[model samples]
Target: MTKTITAVGFNFDEKQSEMIEKKLQRVSYAEEHIIDLIVRVKHEKEYSFDIVANFRWGVQANVKAEDFDFGAALNKVMDVLDQKIKKEKEKVQQH
Candidate 1:
């Protein structure tokens, strides 16, 4: 799979980028396909985290969360993505 994790709308340090990449990679278990992930962290009054996973199958999933802690927001977003992927996997399997 062509996997890429990118951060937009905010600056991410190397360590934070690596952490997000690793976490996302662990959640990605799809077969041969092009997968592009966009991770956006927006900080205004509160921090907003948005993750978008796009696949060649035309399956697109987005997770969003807001939190004071960046790591916590990332974790929440990842969990939401994990659940969405699992649901999609089941749907594909059933078809």
Candidate 2:
């Protein structure tokens, strides 16, 4: 799948980018079914994470979360994303 990560209001370093990639491995089983995965992180008073997963069959799922710590927010968002992906996969299989 094609993956895109964008960060606003902060200098997103290589380490952080790598961390995201590593975290995304949680959903690697559904990679072939995913068309694109977009992640946007905004930092104001706190960190906000917005993730969109576009499936090959034209389905889309979005998950969002916010936290004072970057890692915490990322973890929260990714956990939600993992669940969404699993649900979508089940739907596709049933059809």
Best by TM-score: 2
Clashes of each: 0, 0
Candidate 1 residue runs with Cα over 4 Å from true position: 2-9, 31-34
TM-score of each: 0.79, 0.95
Q: Mind giving the per-residue lDDT tens digits that candidate 2 earns over 1-95?
A: 99999999897888888889899988889899999999999999999999999999999999999999888999999999999998998998999
lDDT of 1 by residue, 13-88 (tens): 8888777777877675754433677777787666688877776678888889988887788888888988887787
Off by over 4 Å in 2: none
lDDT of 1: 0.74
Q: For model 1, what is the error of residue 66's alpha carbon versus the real structure, in angstroms, after optimal superposition?
A: 1.2
Flag clash pairs in model 1. none
